[model samples]
Target chain A: MTKKNKSALSEHTGISSPEITSSNAIETLKAKRKARIDTNTLVSSILNKNIAALSRAITLVESENHKHLEQANTIIKACLPHANKSIRIGITGVPGVGKSTFIEAFGKHLTSQGKRIAILAIDPTSSITKGSILGDKTRMETLAKDENAFIRPSASGTSLGGVARKTRESIILCEAAGFDVILIETLGVGQSETTVHSMIDFFLLLKLAGAGDELQGIKRGIIEMADAIAINKADGENLKQAKLAKVEFNRALHLYPPKPSQWSPKVMLCSALQNEGIKDIWKLILEYKTKTTENNYFETNRTKQNKFWLIQTIENELKRSFFNKKEIKEALEAQLKLIETNKTTPFAAADYLLSLNKSLQ
Target chain B: MTKKNKSALSEHTGISSPEITSSNAIETLKAKRKARIDTNTLVSSILNKNIAALSRAITLVESENHKHLEQANTIIKACLPHANKSIRIGITGVPGVGKSTFIEAFGKHLTSQGKRIAILAIDPTSSITKGSILGDKTRMETLAKDENAFIRPSASGTSLGGVARKTRESIILCEAAGFDVILIETLGVGQSETTVHSMIDFFLLLKLAGAGDELQGIKRGIIEMADAIAINKADGENLKQAKLAKVEFNRALHLYPPKPSQWSPKVMLCSALQNEGIKDIWKLILEYKTKTTENNYFETNRTKQNKFWLIQTIENELKRSFFNKKEIKEALEAQLKLIETNKTTPFAAADYLLSLNKSLQ
Candidate 1:
């Protein structure tokens, strides 16, 4: 404890103090436990308006590290009471549809009206490189810098299609942190749009107006899931084409039955670059909410969506586990070979493989 | 001494030879073991100019007794070498499309051509009533008595949509038995049509012309899968409309990509009831086969189909076993509760439940 003793200890240990290694080890242990505790506490604190804690909690939830998941779950649970306040809107379109630019314009317009906004970019498309995320933020500089607007570029290292569960859970955390409106931006990976739609209150599909031939490749089921179709970049020379495309979409919409929510999806045109029709888009969403809520479709839809997620998640997990089984690994290979050779019917082979798994159990 | 003993035994048993209970028990045991051996042999023997075995095998395959499936498999395997020679065709349409009557007409035509034929009715709509199968055969009495033709009704105690797997396997058996063509008749359930399509070399979708509203509910995907769309009941007053529908289908076929085999799926008009266009209808299926086989599409498709069954079978088994777990029972219940309460994301709850499954060794 004396100065002379401390110097001797530092010199002998080569660590400035003999207790440094042990203390550092202790500190590391404490930090991990603290992180775990903080996740849940941060969730609660952020629910009470603590921004720093909320950021940490969302980070934990999005992490791929196995240890982080439980802490993330606890945090999500703590934040649950304060969540579900905001209107969660999911926006998706093909790669070149100017989604970030539209979000920037859309967010600014909302903030101008004194509305607080949270932009949660759930990019399930490609990996989020540092350069790309920065580029995305740079494009939305105006909205990014606004005090009333919170823009979070998607967190890194998760499944493509934007770590569906994390993005969904993060929405709750963001809403609990008091952002009145939540915007979820999804990439136009054919299937990710469906995942995003399942989580959000409103799903808006953006399209680039073009010939009908181009529309054939996109899956019809996805087009039917959209609550509203906005033909982006609708100004300038493309204006007439955009209008025609809108008409086409409206005709297509007629072929589909009304959604279970009883919402008659709308098709509109907008030039996100010129910030044209941004206000009308917002107004339409509000009207949708009002109509659906009046009909009690909003609450019912959200509940049904929740149930769908649960079943989907369980089914996916079951599939993953079955494929992962060691015994099943060999049995499947053999069964597949037999199947390829046409020695057995698929149902019979399936029964045989399944019986093997059951026996093991 | 042997004659005296035989007389005493017969007298004591109160029978011409053996005791009735002992005789019945031996017969049951023998039947069970035979059933376990594979039913194909019986089908092959019966179909390959052996009427007795074919009838016996069909009965065995249709038996509700657990031992029959084994016998069926055995008989079928024995019959396999004879199966691949026939052209398999699937026929399906809504009720009153005159399915039974059409088959009668078609069967008679084939028999007249000196071509042996076999028909298996797969009717999910009609339960296995005491007379339903026999009734279909009775309706086609003239065809049924033809030495060159065979007609089997839908089996009871199996999933609807057609003759069960054993029945399909039996088709191959019948073909090997020297039947040049096999026709699968399915009840007009729209969805079930897809199941039948996967197994057949050519799929014939029978539709009543001008059934517009009903057609809308029938998915376009299924229509796209059809190799030939036949506007059936095209005789008399319906003839003109049937032709128009056939033309419309031809146009629709143009929209789909050239099938992978480069086979141009044909659309045609026919009246199974009036026997109108029956010969042309068979000609179309034959032409399709010839064209596809010339391009090697026919063999390639069969291989692909076999592979599909293998993977599909394994996947189903995995699903069944995973869901059957005791832990999943609790996990599912818990997740359902969370889903109901909106406490967890469906994806997250699914991941958690799946993680609880015994880790693959």
Candidate 2:
């Protein structure tokens, strides 16, 4: 059998089945036919809010096989029309900043308000473990059991770029599956925050009050990218400190030039454990949505982001193809050594290497 | 004459002299031969601290003529062995922050210490005006006349990439001319500050006292890139306010993560008019240099910067070539319209556009 057919068959079986009797082969062929039909049916099922189909479609999008890629593209094409109808929010904080608890509380609040919520994560570190850090259903017990909420862990082990692409595609599947709100979670330590920030309409950074190292929870540029900051765990003894932290963050935000979005970033206090101040944070998101929608920044920003990702993808592909060239790879180390020794300028070396690429001619 | 010869002749004449009789042509040919010999002479003159040779070489590097690029590259190749011997400092501040006066005072101070200083500016705004805002000799009258100081305004307006390339090349020529101190000035209002930051060994931000809008003078990322912050105009009534600002800025810097270079950025107060604290600022730079050099960060940082520029130039060139394709240009607007209307995904559009470029295949 061809490799493609073998992979396609294995895709449905979830295992590589060796050759068997003619009857088993016939059954395998039947399953392959059914999988083809399932692609279209999956779209209709997703549109009707079939959770199982939505999950399977997301799996297909995350698959590395060529056949799965083609199927995923078709699924995405069908889902595209229904996507972008949800409010996507990216939540991030350091590991101990109660991100999961805050998200669980926040997700439950949204569901209680009659909004269907889908929670996703883009954890770069999870790729190495082959299991998502946020995927443990026990961490979000209440939300995990809620019929109105769907929680997904970060896609299993892949490059950040690969993981980011899968999560973004999964967003389309979730939106088409009738989720009205999407919550994207990322660890504050890595570049995942920036990727999550770009894909979401609102970026919410969660910080701990009086950590004494308040800025330590988030990366340097991440604060500047935030649409709003929440000092999480602001209950009990931490109340006064949280309030002061809010004021301090507000002052720091003011020091930054106004965002091009024309809406000033805000600071708020919240306690996920107490389930306090949750509604106020949602209200802030609503107000931001209103202001940005009125100013047309909401749609324009998405369009700009789309274009940015498009060009970025192209650039990445071009660079990959260029560097993957065997000849160029062999020459690069020597050329870099020349640059290090100051025997040749960077521009001159770049010119020489580019001249070596046959495709440029 | 061929275009190459025509341009080569124009390089020496500074104009296109119309065709002449044999006798006049012989004289022109002699001058052209002399110009060919002058290329090597220019290298020797620059190595001998001939200011005129350095100036002319910089102009050649900045020229638009294709012919001059070859000549400039030749001169740069010869100078490579003599470069990388200077301590390059990048200074930036907003328009009303008294950048010119501060630089003038700083330049004079360096010259007084028996240091030959070469000052260059990277003004993005000047590119649109086709004349450099800082190029006026009158702006730094004293420094312009100082025998130990060579002050050149921003190169005639070009794209930021073009201007940055020219300035970087000019640094090589300046260093070859035995200028041990180089100060690169950039207007704080644009992306030019980041460009200047990447190319220099140390970055200094100059501000004013009692400005109320202290952060208003620079972009969000610029402060994080600074090696030290200097509050200028600190003498007179502004002294008290300047000291307060210094403390505030110190607190702010402490909030940032430690730089990879392992040197803590410092904040100081200075007054250009009174020339107070000028020496102290220099001392700070010297201290930073000693610390970084001992840690080997200075050399490593320069090497990293070289590799960065090399890759960046390749990326930019690849993007330029791809986008400049006539067919791609024609299709881009329509594809952008599709994206704006959400009729297609950015990934799908990028794939389609990449396929259109025959070179990719």
Best by lDDT: 2
The ten-residue window of minimal lDDT in model 1 chain B covers B213-222
- Clash pairs for candidate 2: A127-A157
lDDT of each: 0.73, 0.85
Each candidate's fnat, listed in order, reads 0.63, 0.68
For residues B150-243, could you state the per-residue lDDT of candidate 2 as single tens digits?
Answer: 9887876556877888898899999999998999998888889888988999999988766665444323477789999999989878889899
Q: If scored against the real structure, what TM-score would every candidate get?
A: 0.80, 0.86
lDDT of 2 by residue, A230-306 (tens): 99989999899889999989987876778978989999899999999899999999999999999999999899988
lDDT of 1 at A260: 78
Evaluate every candidate with DockQ and list the scores: 0.45, 0.47
Give me candidate 1's TM-score against the actual structure. Answer: 0.80
Clashing residue pair totals per candidate (backbone < 3 A) = 24, 1
The DockQ leader among the candidates is 2
lDDT of 1 at A290: 93
The lDDT, on a scale of 0 to 1, for candidate 2 is: 0.85
